[model samples]
Target: MSIDFGLIFARMPEILAAFWVTVWIWIVSNVLAVFLGFGVATLRRYGPLWLDLLLRLLVEIIRGTPFLVQLFLLYFGGPFIGLSLDPIPAGLLGMTVYSTAYYSEIFRAGYNAIPVGHIEAAECVGLTRGQIIRRILVPEMTMLVLPQCVNMAILMMKETAILSIITVPELTLVVGAIGSQQYAFVEAMLLLALFYWFLVELSGFLGRIAEARLSKFRFAHS
Candidate 1:
């Protein structure tokens, strides 16, 4: 049977709307996860031993499990524990928590990449710890960590498709609905792939811009 690409393009408005839903979820979830991961790593790196152990255990547990299971537990299992959430919020919460574990490791690696001599030099220059972190460490750590963080962000964007399983009204779910309704599974699926590809390309473009801007700081300093 010949395919009618025209029918799929007819639904472009709905598809684009669904795409925005996916984008918003990804943006909010990644923002929260990245910052929270940094906070977790910083606390674990500098906090008391007991706190470090506790945070380490939490990260380990999250990293050890599949995100699908966590999403199910958070959305389907929450009602049993007297916590209820709508599908979108539950999905966002699950994604943020799960991604935070991996983001924390990326951040930890960035921190470790810093040279001891740099910190010592800042100390020798009479910079306070806060000033050293604000003026010295954060800038360098961002440069070191950005590529890995971008990779994770792209991964998270793809993973947002899974939120469709919980009926989050994201791009995949909308596409699935249209496919079933129109009996055009092949066309719908192709559109789905194309949509995701666009998102991935956009992410790569933005990441390149960020990396380029970060590079300028180094040249300016030099």
Candidate 2:
């Protein structure tokens, strides 16, 4: 069968609009995930035992389940619990919860990697716990975990496609609708792949640049 590249060209506007929607969700979710994950990691390290156990259980539950199931529960099952949410909100909530679980572990590993002596030294300097975390631990941990965070960020971006199943109007959903209406599944699938490829590549490129600059900053400071 012959391919019609013109269909892709004609759908460029819709594709671009959906692409931005995906990116926007990704940005908002991951930003919240990063900070919330760090907080979860920190609490697990230093908070009360009950709180730690509760968070640990939560993290494991989130990590253990499939994201699609989680999204479905949030979007479809929420109404049963008197907590209904619209598609975009449900999608964002699901993405944030899912990403936060993994990001918490990534940050937990970063916390472990820091030398105990560094914390001891900060203590000797009369730095408060919050001060040390903000001024020292956060900066060091960010540098150490930048690569892992980038990988997670890309993973989250791809997972945004799953939100299309909940009818979020993201790139994948729009493309799928086009494919269904036009009977051009092959062309639609190819175009969808191309858009995702560009997004992933762009994320990786930006991640590498950030890593390089951070590496230089660490080296110079050392």
Q: Each candidate's root-mean-square deviation in Å?
A: 2.1, 1.7
Stretches of candidate 2 exceeding 4 Å from the true structure: 219-222
Can you write out model 1's per-residue Cα lDDT over 149-219, one digit (the tens) per residue?
A: 99999999999999999889999999889887888888888878987998899998999899888876652
Number of clashing residue pairs, candidate 2: 0
> Against the true structure, whose lDDT is highest?
2
RMSD of 1: 2.1
> Residues 117-172, candidate 2, lDDT per residue (tens digit)?
88899999999999999988888888999999999999999999999999999999
After superposition, which runs of candidate 1 have C-alpha atoms over 4 Å from their true positions?
A: 219-222
Cα lDDT, model 2, residue 80: 100
Error of 2 at 169 (Å): 0.2
Cα lDDT computed for each candidate against the true fold: 0.89, 0.92
Q: What lDDT score is found at residue 107 in candidate 1?
A: 89
The candidate that wins on TM-score is 2
